[model samples]
Target chain A: MKLTFPHLGNAYIAVKALLDELGVDYIIPPFNNKKALEIGIKNSPEFACLPLKINIGNIIQAYREGADTVLITGGCGPCRFGYYCEMEREILQDAGYDIGFITIDAPRGISLKEYFSQLLKITNGINIYKIAKAVKNTTEIAILVDQLEKLTFKMRSIEACRGDTDSVYRDFQQEIRLINGAQSIKKYISQTSQKLTNIRCNTGIKPLKVGIVGEIYTTIDSYTSFNLDARLGNMGVEVDRSVTVSNWVVEHMLKKVFHLPRDLKYAEAAKPYLGAMIGGHAQETIGNSIMYSQKGYDGIVQIYPLTCMPEIVAQSILPAVENDYGIPVLTLIIDEMTGEAGYLTRLEAFVDLLNKRREMAASDR
Target chain B: MRTGGQPIEALRKGMEYLAGQLGNIEIRGAGTTGSGRQLASVIIGADIVKNEITAHAVAAQNLVPEVKTILEIGGQDSKIIILKNGVVYDFAMNTVCAAGTGSFLDRQASRLNIPIEEFGSYALRSDSPVRIAGRCAVFAESDMIHKQQMGHRVDDIVRGLCQALVRNYLNNLAKGKLIAEPILFQGGVAANVGITAAFEEALGKKVIIPEYYDVMGAYGAALIAKRKMEKSIDTNFKGFDACLRDYSARSRECSGCSNVCEVIELFSNDELLASWGDRCGKWSSRLEGRPLVAR
Candidate 1:
């Protein structure tokens, strides 16, 4: 049976590997795009969150391609994301799309013993060992790819200064695709790091660096910020994104279980601003921005949906952080109407101001 | 201002600065919305903290005055509001979808090796509209590639994609909802000519994209707050410099019941100014000085 799955960062990569191991045919939906949003927007309630729209688009895309079943994750929490499967199912059914949706909820709400049984429903007696191996490989591949991308991005700033970013980035991307086949995460990480180190960068003067912190999806999804990082990079500024799908997963799951401080307890900081579970990671984002600014990032940019409740709470409190930290903060609320020109103009101006500050600082030194 | 500690005093001073910017103009009443609505109300002393839909509708009505249908799409979501005689009659929102939104377009453009700014312009140049199945993004991409192999012009393909988007929007969000003309498309997406053209073609009429579409929501919220200020005895605007304070928030998990709701408490100094997050009003009411009433 041909299977389909929605985009949720590395989830697709992991699922794809699992399907491959099970010897099942599956098609992962393409990265999120306008057509998907259009289809999703058309097929969804007008007030749902951004991720939902993309997922709807993803499922619809899969169905149209003759994928009979779509796999999705289920959650139980104050966050509205937990209810996505039910909501998406209803929307697709209303739009007259026929497909099977299989959801895997966290086994916490149910007996852990039943977890494997639930999996068996879809796997249909597939080898447990193979499934485990596939999952491991997929996770490793995703982590490796992500690590390489981050390193490439880090190298790009210096490469650009050296006037070889374009060529180096192309090579870096190819190397990442190859390293995805690495047998272990350790090997992948090491090779990726070495590749980045090999690239010669002209470290003449330090450029003004900015950190971006916000909702998980919006922060990583280029579509959400109109590819703000590339724009910043083009303007000769290094942009550091504070949120990642892996980081989020680790913080929400592993860190909590281990009581590790690896994840900033942003929920604690955002408690006052958010005051309740409006269901999004806005609090953690604001807290991250504060942390980043404290660490001396020249500027901070917070991007979120126009009416996103969590981000709104963060925005209200960000002004205070910006003031205390003496860091310039720009809050851009994205909705459908954010124009390329308008967005680019703001980026250009922000970068120009940052560049000026860096020059002034250098002169003062 | 002196009643609170350093942070509260700093916030108060900032609020005063904001108040000064308004000069002698009196803010009579105010309204708030979004996740931060309640907190914003508490901070600004707003008279109303309504939902986003209501706040947006109110602002649109005031701005356009004759607006019939309102289309608002943001970074992560999209919404359509139908108004009759300046009052919201019906509304729909697509908060789940990212395909038709600006960010989705941004992603596609970057992937296509095209600057997002030039994406609409490319669509405008298309002569023949390519029939892209804009039902879902993944399908559409493969379909577009197939169309490309079929030798369809890029412009036509782009135009077709735009049309498909408009079709998807109408079919999903606007389904069963009356889409009457004088339809004012306000939001980030209205800025795209290709999408706008697709909308016009789909609706077979002119779609009015308002000025300041990008900031309309914030603008609308601000306008509602401004209106409310007029109706109030005193304006609650915390002022501009309020941003210069060391404001922070804390959380405490309530043990009221099985819910064990995590209640967030806002403090200016050490004094609790506000608290929220109780599912059954266990903490929110208490912090706001209202007695908790059992449901």
Candidate 2:
């Protein structure tokens, strides 16, 4: 069976590693671009969120490229994300593309038998030892990719040369798509990490720190956020986000199956604002905002798609947090309708505000 | 509305007026802020360039030190900036909708054959105003026309339009953020007393219009330029004579990739001054380190 999955930042690297280890034939659809968005918009239900539409586009593009089966994670949250797989299947079937779907949902919601059957479909009759080894390699690749990205985020703000880090990152991204197998990807990541460390940086300048907190998919996908991390970094600000591909895999997938204790730092910090998960990372959004504020971040930026229920709740409550903590919160609601000019204006203004606040605080002290 | 060519004319006229009033004063610093900031900077050789939100907030704060909220509605866009402790805390600009901007008001006033400046006075004359939909510009126009055709007084319809715009601004931009006291209202739309009164009625707080309300963004840009010049003694003001030079702009779709970025090239009498709008930066980066004006 030929496998295909939606792009989620660098998560595709780990997935590629996994599929390669399993000796499965898979087609990686073109990176999320204007064509994908147009095709998705044409085929998707009008009111569906941006991520859902993008996923549909990715699947169809892959299908045209000879992908016969789709592998995607499932959620049982209060958000509409829980129903994405079923919706995509229905839409694809109606469009006459007969494709198989393998959804790996959290084990709590489904029987162990059903879960293993889905897993077995992916395993494709491989031995258990080989599957275990593949899983181990995939996890390492995921962590390495996330680590490299974090390093790039930090270095981009401090690099002495303006485009050094970005050029290296662009090269790394281009190279990874062609690299095969877990070992080669891991080796390439280390080489890219070494290249990043070699760039000259200014250590004395204390760059403004900003935290990006919002819906998981939007925060993870650079195409969705219009390359927010790189844009902020280029503005000479250090930007970090609470959601990464590895973080999502660990928090949502691995922890559930292994019965690992959930991380409560974000939950505890979020408690005063949101006591429970309202689904789709709403609690995490509030929690991360509070956490960043406490950690003395210069500002917090919250991004979510239009008509997002949980983030809308988070956006309303952020002002109170801003008032109490004396930190500025910029909430950006994006969709296909979001103009680049307007978005950049808001971002530039927010950065300016943070810089002015810091200068005032320094003067007062 | 100022076209691509009109800004040069407008800037020249504005500078000529200033030079006439100030005599032979030295131009210390120059700056540009707004949607046309990039083009304006290139034309005038501005030393600093900034976005309108920062410009508006800076201007309002300079005018009123304790200003907490700034409501600025320009020709095509509107924005609300919230400030606290003399710094900008948050701001929101209207997106993808030009429902209640000054241009919309201008169009409606001309349709009614009333001078745009006197349109607000007609609203003040009416005690009973009709209800108009403020959700979309097209709907609002049709609603106004329908009310006009039904023999409703022009004054009442004008007042309704003002209230509708105020309502739309509050709903879309304000969105439950605290519109604090000591609020300052500026921008081109601030000249309309009807919209200002509508804002006061809806906000339940007096909105103070700065002395130079219409030119506040430019004022802020000037303040920023002055502050910026403190560190560097050199000025890039290019003199008011740059305004007299012939200027033209053209755009072409780049074939360099699937992005098809429309690269804009601005020319000053045949010497290419600058080019921008390409995502890959191949066009813009080409002119770096070159003297801006060949003459």
Candidate 3:
């Protein structure tokens, strides 16, 4: 079967590795653009959210590129994401695309028997050892991508040469993209880290730190937010992202199976600002912002789609958090009409505010 | 199709205009707002560059100390700012739709062969306003055309359009907000008396228009610059002389990675003055000393 899936940041790297190791023929949809959004909006139900429409457009585009099987992950929250697979299937059927779908539910969320049965469909002909190796490689790939991204954030702020951090980071991504198997990832990380240390950064000036928190879809997708993290890094501000695709995989796939102590620290931190999960990462947004502030992050940037219920709720509560914690917060709501020019202005303004705050605090001390 | 020129040239002219108004006096500090704030900041070497929301709120607070709410409708967007004790407490901007903004009114007015300046006067004369769908632009346009085809008076149709814009603005923005008065109606759309009347009729309270309603964003930015100068050593303003120099901006797509970030470079007098636009600091990081042509 020719397989395909929607692009959601670096999640595609691990997924591509998995598909490659599975020896499956697959199609990766073209990057999102006006054409994709146009196709998506025309085909999707009027009231559906943006992500849903975009994914459908991706699937249709993939179909045109000869992909017949659509692979998607089951959701873990009350967000419309939990119902996306079924809704998309029905819509595709109505549109006359006879595509096969493979929806992978988190193994940790389901019984072992159910998990094994679902896994059986993909592993039908492969040997048990080969399947085990593929799983290991796939998880490692996720961990590696997360590591590279986080390192880029830290290195971008400190690197002395103009493009040193960026060139190294870009090269690392290219290097990893060509590699397969679990063993190569550890070596890749070490080699990249060594190269990073060789470059010098200014030691006299302290880097301003900012934390990113918001709805999962927007927060996870760099393209959606116009590569905001990297932009902050360009301004010499080190950004800490609370959510990553790898974090989600471990939380949803491995936590229960390993019987690991649940890291509910964020939920605890959010308890004071937001008592419970009101749906769609709102709790995490509050929790992570608090956590970042307590860790001495100078500011918080909350990015989400326009009219996103959870983020709007989170946006309302962020000012209180900022006031109480002595950190600045900027909430940026995006839509189809979110002009990059306006977005950049807000970001630069926020960064300027943070710098002024730092100067004032230092002078006070 | 390419009738509109680059923002850089317009920004230089705006800086020159601001300088002319101030009359050779050193701008104590400089701040920029609106969508082109970045280009303006780069061109003028501004000290503060803020969002239109913060800039508008500040301008309103300075002009009317008792303004509790601000309703801003510009060429392409609209928003409601709820102020508490002279601080920006809350705000909501229009999303996914541009129906209630000045551009729609401009389009409809031009379609009717009515000058945009006199469009509001026509609405003021209307007695029988029709109901036009303002939920979305496409529906609003078709509905307005339908009304006109039925031989409705041009003034009534114009009034109907104004009412529709106000309805869409309030429903989309001010729902459930503690939108108190002395409310200030500001932005480019504030020039339209029809919308001002519509707002007054709907809210059942007087909607005060600021003196420089169309330019409140700039006014607010100047206030921010004033506040900034009170605490800073000197202004970053590049001075009026910078406007005379020939400057150019070009964008190059970086094939560095999968993102393919496009980097922008600005040149003045054939020397590189500024470069940005890439998310990764690959190009911008190479920036050394600030370009000195402004001096």
Strongest candidate by lDDT? 2
Number of the top-ranking candidate, with DockQ as the measure: 2
Span of ten consecutive residues with least summed lDDT in model 3 chain A: A106-115
Model 2, A108-185: lDDT tens digits are 366545655666787768876787688789888999999999998899899886667867787788789999999999
The count of backbone overlaps in candidate 2 is 0
Candidate 2 per-residue lDDT, tens place, B132-160, comes to 99989999999999999999999999999
In terms of docking quality, how is candidate 1 classified?
incorrect
Better of 2 and 3 by DockQ: 2
DockQ of each: 0.01, 0.42, 0.23
Q: What is the lDDT of candidate 2?
A: 0.86
lDDT per residue (tens digit) for residues B204-251 in model 1: 888888787776765677775666565545665554544455566778
| Arranged by DockQ, best first | 2, 3, 1
What is the C-alpha lDDT profile of model 1 across A1-365, one tens digit per residue? 67888876444544554566566767767656667778887777777777778789889987888888877766665256677778877888888888877766552444433544555667768866765575556556556556655665566566523323434443433343223322543464566578667866767946578888776666776655666665566456677876765565455543444457764465565555455555566767676777777677888888876567777777767767765666766667675555544454345545644554556666779
Question: Alpha-carbon interface RMSD of model 3?
Answer: 5.6
* Model 2 / residue A33 / CA error / Å: 1.3
lDDT of 2 at A14: 96
TM-score of chain A of each: 0.83, 0.97, 0.91
Q: What residue pairs are clashing in model 3?
A: none
Cα lDDT of all candidates, in order? 0.65, 0.86, 0.80
